[model samples]
Target: MAKTLDELLTVTAPVDLPSYDSRATTGFDGKKADAEKQLTQLGEELSNLQEKLFAGGRSGASPTRVLVVLQGMDTSGKGGIIRHVAGLVDPQGLAITSFKKPTPEELEHDFLWRVESRLPQPGEIGVFDRSHYEDVLIGRVRQLATPAEIERRYGAINDFEKAFTDSGGILVKCFLHITKDDQKERLAARLDDPTKHWKFNPGDLDERMLWDDYQRAYALALERCSTDHAPWHLVPSGRKWYRNWAVATLLLEQLRALDLSWPQADYDVEAEKTRLAGM
Candidate 1:
């Protein structure tokens, strides 16, 4: 069985990270290795199941849809997870969209408009790199909204998600949790490596300076938004390998539960076989 959101978050660490300003760097190398092995096995099983679903003509019949939202700070492996996990799904039935700072036209619409416009149709899996939660997370953290406004938006988001679930969409939201120390190390690595420099934004360091603020914002976001229908998974991401495994495992578990089936065939297989043989 897949780990429930509560169970996954309840597993105590050897050292509790500073709730507000974490600079801790305890490695989970052993756990990561184990997770990697488990992920490999799970990945194979998921691939096999997906192939059966597609080959059995199930893709067109049941038309189940999944929406996976990944949200975290800069360089939290959101892009990497998208590249790997979505690669496992059928390319023909998947859509991946990355949200950045709003464009001029997007600024004219409500926060959820851009996200709602990108929702996948039936039988498709849609991956959002950074999602509407940004409004709650960054918007609140940056004090872009009043407390009253934030509270109002919280209920709005809940209702929005409920509507999706009611309409046959499976929603999975993951918050990639990484320590400040790990983020610092990643930032440094990006600076040293020429190829990765493009990913290093000075603004990310600016945000790092307000790391404590971000954590508080995240804690509240998780508390407010995590629901019975659309819960949040806080994946420990100090280690990237473990992060990938955790996400892949969660996705595989959810997809496996979806019991996809093929449409009924109109013609008899025996008749078709005989007709083909004669030709």
Candidate 2:
């Protein structure tokens, strides 16, 4: 049997992330039609919650922001999740960054330097398509950095994420766990459809060759960096629809936990009404 999202979290939430299945759809028993309906509803609720978070300054406190970091292999639906789930929110309250190869300047500084400037402001939700973890994942798999350097980066990542949360940022890290066979199918589908031909990269196959190495790197990254403040979660992503739904649900869970409310109006309602009536 598949596990519920909550159940999956309970089992995978440990700092040392246990092995997880990538295709479990345990909690959602509904059909596709039902899932779509529920997704629409979730979209609405997400919008409302975002509005409250956006207007947080009206209540005279700095707004609590959230940063959702997504990591996975190519063809893992990171783009799809951003378009489907994060797209539902008001863009004014959202900031997104997709990290690519580092520039000469970026290479000169520490790994986190390029990441610092892209952080979401107060009352905003930030999403990283691929994040600092790349320094460890690709950095390890490709030997861009030595084993000692990779280990040091793990420590740096943990400290950075912890400080982010301590400074009123809520961090949600998700590893879109997809199987090798599933990836091959998706890549083939991309090739099959002319519209998606632009999405296919010849370089992805190169990375695919080092799948086992990448997986080991990921396991180590998750285990070391999944801390109390910014824990990691594995979102089963073999199914595209389920991946979108699960990401949305996970975000909703975090937003709701903040118990955000509309900022109280500073002006007197009755006085404003009287003044407008007189005008």
Candidate 3:
């Protein structure tokens, strides 16, 4: 049987990160090098499979839609992963959305209203940079909602995701796990590099002060919302390369499981040749 999201989350460390020095090698550590290599090979195979699945398919048999929701704190490598791993996917069938602070209209509506409007159509993949989970994660962490309100959203989110999955969409939620120390280092690097200075926002520094609160929020979100259909994976994100590989591997694995093939059709070569000759 396949592993449940809850089981995966339980097995994952709440706050552990791979050592930065260890990332200099191919694997996370020497112990997982072979496994990592295998995953990379699998990712490449999956990429090829995805390409084949999208080719020569028309109205009758549409490919399965994949929805990947990526959520994390400041300085998390969300943009990097999207640029690298998802960049490998066929651009024609993929959609990427990055959610920032709510606009006036969005703030007036329910949190999920905007998200629902952006769902992937058949044969397409939608990637959410920050998703509806924010209603529970950041909403709770920032005390934007009351305890009862936060609790209510937990069930609502689960049901919403269940509906998406039941309707033939595959949902994968990844929480990019990065350490505070690493985040500081990355943020500093961004400031030091002139080209990256534009990426820096002073607001991120404020969020860093509430690191523990965010962690607690994430733990609860993981504990409550991880379901069999849409599981959340905590990607150790200090190493941007490993993070990209892991995300690409998981996506490839999920997409490979989908039945994405063209329906059989009859063709008349002789009739076509005769018609062409007559013409």
Top-scoring candidate (lDDT): 2
The best candidate by TM-score is 2
lDDT of 3 by residue, 1-279 (tens): 865322443223343333322233222343455546765676567667666555523343654578888987877888987777777667886788998777899988877898898888776778999999888877987888899989999898999999999877888788887777878899999999999999999988888888888878887888788777877777767676667776776677677677456545556878888999998
Instruction: Give the poorly placed runs of model 3, Cα more than 4 Å off.
Output: 1-44, 52-60, 266-279
Give the local distance difference test score of model 1: 0.74
lDDT of 2: 0.85
Clash-forming residue pairs, model 2: 2-26
Candidate 2 stretches greater than 4 Å from native: 1-7, 10-19, 57-60, 267-279
For 45-109, candidate 1 gives per-residue lDDT tens digits of 76766655544433355545678889888878898888766776667767789998889898788
Clashing pairs in 3: none
Q: On a 0 to 1 TM-score scale, where does candidate 2 land against the true structure?
A: 0.91
Task: Write model 2 residue lDDT over 131-204, tens digit each, in one string.
Answer: 99999999999999888898899999999988899988998788888988889999999999999999999999
Displacement of residue 72 (Cα, Å) in model 1 is: 1.0
Model 1: ten consecutive residues of lowest lDDT: 20-29
